[model samples]
Target: MAQGSGGNVIAAICNLFFPGLGQLVQGRIIAALIFAIIVVGGYALWWLVIPAIIAGVFHLWSIIDAARFKASD
Candidate 1:
């Protein structure tokens, strides 16, 4: 397994801009899609400004977690 620490770091940075961005960076299409929907839905429900922010934080966390992925040889 390749070391994806860099990708994860990048994803975390992107999460600050938008939720689900980290997942996209990590190649987690499904997770990214789900998070995207949640982000969108949050916005739909009264602009979801606060929830969006929270999601952004969580997204970053996910990215960090992905970065910790150690490849097993």
Candidate 2:
């Protein structure tokens, strides 16, 4: 899929619900795992304000990353 395509839009929506899900949908297993681990781990430690903020940042990053992803030609 190209960047800014329908697939990217769907992936972005997926990431909106779950950070790593969009990467997974785009067939990027490593990115999906990394995003999932960081986001989920941070959320698990949400009692700490810093981690929670970090999680939120990562979550938005994940969404944007998925939205902007371009498949290699």
Candidate 3:
């Protein structure tokens, strides 16, 4: 909402639609793909269930990470 607000805020918001989307928004290509595999793959294998739940956790982590991401880190 401020002039200096970083891309992380935007990225985190983007993550709401899907996991790894934030990373993609932040230009974290590898992270995006990796997360996409983890989360998307988890959803694909819905029968397994456990991994999918874990992926949900990962998605939450992604949101937090994106919110805190900095160019330096």
**Candidate 2: stretches off by over 4 Å:** none
Candidate numbers, best TM-score first, in rank order: 2, 3, 1
Worst lDDT run of 10 residues, candidate 3, spans: 1-10
Cα RMSD of all models vs. native, in order, equals 3.6, 0.6, 3.2
Question: How much lDDT does each candidate structure score?
Answer: 0.65, 0.95, 0.80
Give the true-structure RMSD of model 2. Answer: 0.6
TM-score of 1: 0.58
Compare candidates 2 and 3 on TM-score and give the better one.
Answer: 2
Q: What TM-score does candidate 2 get on C-alpha atoms?
A: 0.97
How well is each residue in 2-71 modelled by candidate 3, as lDDT tens digits? 2235677888888878888988987889998888788888878778989889888888888887788767
* Per-model TM against the reference: 0.58, 0.97, 0.82
Decide which is better by lDDT, 2 or 3: 2
Q: How many clashing pairs in candidate 1?
A: 0
Q: CA shift at 72, candidate 2, in angstroms? A: 0.7
lDDT over C-alpha atoms for residue 15 of model 2: 96
